[model samples]
Target: MLFRQLFDAESSTYTYLIADHTTKAAVLVDPVLEQVERDLKLLKELGLILHYCLETHVHADHVTGTDRLRQATSCSGIVPDRAHVACADRHIKDGETLHLGDITITAIATPGHTDSHMAYLVNDDRVLTGDALFIRGCGRTDFQSGDAGTLYDSVTKHLFTLPDETLVYPAHDYRGHTVSTIGEEKRWNSRFAERDGRGANRLRHRPSFIEFMNHLNLPDPKKIMEAVPANEMCGHLAATA
Candidate 1:
């Protein structure tokens, strides 16, 4: 398996190119619009054909390049079944697996950041966490049907159960920390550490949604409204042009 992790400094977003070296087939995860040209250029240089473009969620940050890339390269755009994005060629459900040459990617429905959010588990060991889990902190549950207790459950019940060594690659991070292991985050994350009890008790005592959002300090995603609709429609502007 060959992988390239690309970073956009402006939004602190990371896009991934996971490929099978033998087949020269690749898939992109959570791509940013501004980095589309660079991403496509690199793919061309690498002698690889893009098989799919995947989104973890409908982003509130930068516009997704999935539509433009799909039109440019004729690649399929894959997103969660619950996502209302029109550009998605395939709507994947939890436990659904996608084949990219020799590699297999599984979709895990991890709703907290947004109701339709997903986390892609790649090759069993690596996960594209989207905005759900950051290196040290988890995503804020204050917007777009975001709930603190739901987020807590998703983290402790769904994600934390993965192997301790599972590599966690998040979508954005303002801090320089690029990546971490499930075990590392499980032990060190302050939010999870403070939550007491299990199941009902955990949910009952969870922090207020407002309080949690306040601490997150997340800036409004640049041009979100413009970006989202365009992205959902598979780069409508780029497609038309």
Candidate 2:
């Protein structure tokens, strides 16, 4: 197995590249359009075949490189079915398996950040959590039709169920932290601590989570007005549109 975690400083986003060294086949998860040339160059230099560009959800913060990568590599574009992007080469449903040579990727429907958000479990060892789960703090549930309660359930119930040692790779982290484990997050995540501070026994984590989410007045992504529409079109922009 070949793996690399690439970062974009401007967006503070993490793009992943995974490949099966034996077959020289690879895929990029949550690719950013601005980094397309870099990603393409890496694939070419490594003598790898681009297989698929997998999006965790319809992101409002940054335009995706899926469309452009497809044009350059003939790789398929795979986005969550619920996103309704319509232009994706394939719409993957929950529990579906995606393959890269000998590697198998399973789609885990985690939702919350956006209704169709997904986290990919790579061969049961590492989970690509997208924006649904982050290090110490989860994604703000105040925008993009996000739901705090649902996100809480998705994390505590679904993601946390993975083995304590399972590696967590999130899509974005503003701070310098790069990775976390399921156990570490369950223990120290401030968002979870906030839920506990509300007295889980009385308010319950769900209600507290909802209240917490409602009160967070985080600003909208600076690029949402432009990025959303472009992402909806699979990250294509006409000179005039």
Candidate 3:
């Protein structure tokens, strides 16, 4: 199996490229529209066939490259089940798996960043945490049908149950952190875990987490206006209303 992480500077987004070396079949997860050409060139140079473009959710931070990639290659555009992407070629549900030869990508429903978000577990080892759980922080729950309490439950009940050593690859990272382990995040992610007075990290109470999230007062993403609509159409600007 071959796994590569590609970054889009403009949106601070990370697109993933996962493929099976033996079959040369590849899938791009959470791709950004601006980086489509770079992604295509990489696939071509690697002698791989683009099989699918999988979106974690309908993004507000940046438009997806699925439509452009679908036009360039015979790839299907796949989105999370129930996501408002009417143009997607497929909708993947929780526990559903997509195979690229030996590579296994299983979807785990982890909403709250949006009403329908998914984190992909690759081969049961590494997790591609779209936007639900970031390295030190988590996604905001102030918009797009987001709920702070729901995000807390998804992270603690669903994501935190995975193996402690499972690799955490988030969709976006502004702190230059590329990857982390589940154990590390559980122990150190300030948004989910608070430091005790004695210097130990403890799981933050749900009420505290929710309260803090609700009062963040963060600004909306600059691209939200255009990005959301375009993403809903699978990145087809012309089709966006």
Candidate 4:
């Protein structure tokens, strides 16, 4: 298995490139539109064929590169089931696995940040937590049908159930961190856990978590007006217009 984490500094988005070393079949997860050339170059240089372009949800941050990439290659565009992406070649459901040679990517339904979001587990060793769980914080539950309590449940029950040693690769990072383990996040992530008076890490209560999230008052993403509608059309901006 070959894995590469690519970043788009403008949106603080992380686009993942995963491939099977034996067959050279590759998939790009959450790719940004502005970075398509770079991704294509990398794939060409590595002698890999782009098999799929996967989206976790309809993004409200930056436009996706799936449409552009598909135009350039023979890759299929895949989005999470229930996503409003009509142009998607396929919609992946929770627990559904896509095989790239020996590597398997399974989708985990985690809908809070967005009503139709997914977090993918790769080969049971690493998880690509796309906008659902970040390095130390989680996505804001203030829009796109987002709910604080639902987000809390998704993180505490669904994500936290993974193996403690499983590697967590988020879709975006604003704090210069790259990767973290499930145990590390469960113990230290302030959004999910906090240090008790006894100096032990404990999960934040659901009600409290909900209250905290509701009060965050985060501003909308800069590109929401264009990104959301465009993403719904599988990243073809003109289609939504």
lDDT of each residue in 1-241, candidate 1, tens digit only: 8888899987789999999999999999988888999999999999989999999988776778887888789999988878887657899999999887779999888888888888999999999899888997878776767766777777778898999999999998888888899988887776665455442222323565336655776766776666666766766653464
Note the Cα lDDT for every prediction shown: 0.82, 0.87, 0.94, 0.93
- How high is each candidate's TM-score? 0.89, 0.93, 0.97, 0.98
Q: What C-alpha lDDT, on a 0 to 100 scale, does residue 222 get in candidate 4? A: 99
lDDT of 4 by residue, 121-237 (tens): 999999999988999999999999999889888888899999999999998999999999999999999999988899999999999899999999989999999999889887888
**Where does candidate 3 stray beyond 4 Å?**
238-241
Q: Measured by TM-score, how close is model 1 to the native structure?
A: 0.89
Better by TM-score, candidate 4 or 2: 4
Clash pairs, model 4 backbone: none
Clash number for every model? 1, 0, 0, 0
Candidate 3 lDDT (Cα, 0 to 1): 0.94
Tens-place lDDT per residue, model 3, 1-241, is: 9999999999999999999999999999998888989999999999999999999888999988899899999799999999988989999999999999999999999998889999999999999999999998899998999999999999999999999999999999999999999999999999999888999889999999999999999999999999998998999993333
Q: Output the better candidate (1/4) by lDDT.
A: 4
| Clash pairs detected, candidate 2 | none
Better of 1 and 2 by TM-score: 2
lDDT tens digits, residues 1-241, model 2?
Answer: 8889999988899999999999998999999999999999999999999999999998888988888898899998999877979888888998999877778899999989888899999988999999988998888777777889889898888898899899999999998999999888877776764444555422236777788778988888998888888888788872125
